[model samples]
Target: MMRTPAPRLRTYLSGYVLSLVLTVAAYLLVTHPSYSTSLIVGLISALAVVQFLVQLVFFLHISAERKPRWKLMVFIFMVGIVLIIVVGSIWIMNNLNYRMTPQQINTYLNNQGGGF
Candidate 1:
């Protein structure tokens, strides 16, 4: 399909620059060690989501103009699955923490040869 190299290179460079900016922002937040852990985690997560969207649009070439929107549909499905897994894992861990007493945790740890 007689595509020009200049346009493709431009798209790639734009995506690369955006990705680099997001990565550096995340890195600064992590290495500074001034912010609280929760704040740093939240910032990093937001950066990750922005980077994901940039990759989807630029590198993957996903858009309404493209034929067969199934790629976008599949991506949505995969994202849903990932969100389910992460939410489920956090929910399970919270429930376990609530149900297990400190004494029980210590005893279980000792039983597993991780005694202090």
Candidate 2:
């Protein structure tokens, strides 16, 4: 009986350890108050994205050989579009909400009351 090589096992173990570390870091980032909530959330989001890519490439083997590169590119492009739309909508809505004047608010309230 020949012994099987362990390169794949080593790679999988390393990837698992890195994933665990990333998970812990994300948890800590969300729980700690030393940093601003926005900053911590941004950092955690970035880290999560990086970790997801790492897992895809290292553990899932999502390469040209396993699947077509075009499929991966399309997936990434779709995700980018979704992120842009969501972030843009939030930013636009926040600005609109913050910039409402007292007069505008009163006018809306009056309109709602049938101009009473």
Q: Using Cα atoms with residue i matched to residue i, what is each candidate's TM-score against the true structure?
A: 0.76, 0.66
Candidate 1 lDDT tens digits, 19-81: 999999999889887889998999899999999989877787675235556777888899899
Over the full model, what C-alpha lDDT does candidate 2 score relative to the true structure? 0.77
Runs of candidate 2 with Cα error greater than 4 angstroms are 1-11, 36-38, 64-68, 101-103, 112-116
lDDT of 1 at 39: 86
After superposition on all C-alphas, the RMSD of every candidate to the true structure, in Å, is 4.6, 5.8
CA lDDT of each prediction against the hidden true structure: 0.84, 0.77
For model 2, what is the error of residue 91's alpha carbon versus the real structure, in angstroms, after optimal superposition? 1.6
* Model 1 alpha-carbon drift over 4 Å, by segment: 1-7, 102-116
Worst 10 residues of 1 by lDDT: 1-10
Highest lDDT against the true fold, candidate: 1
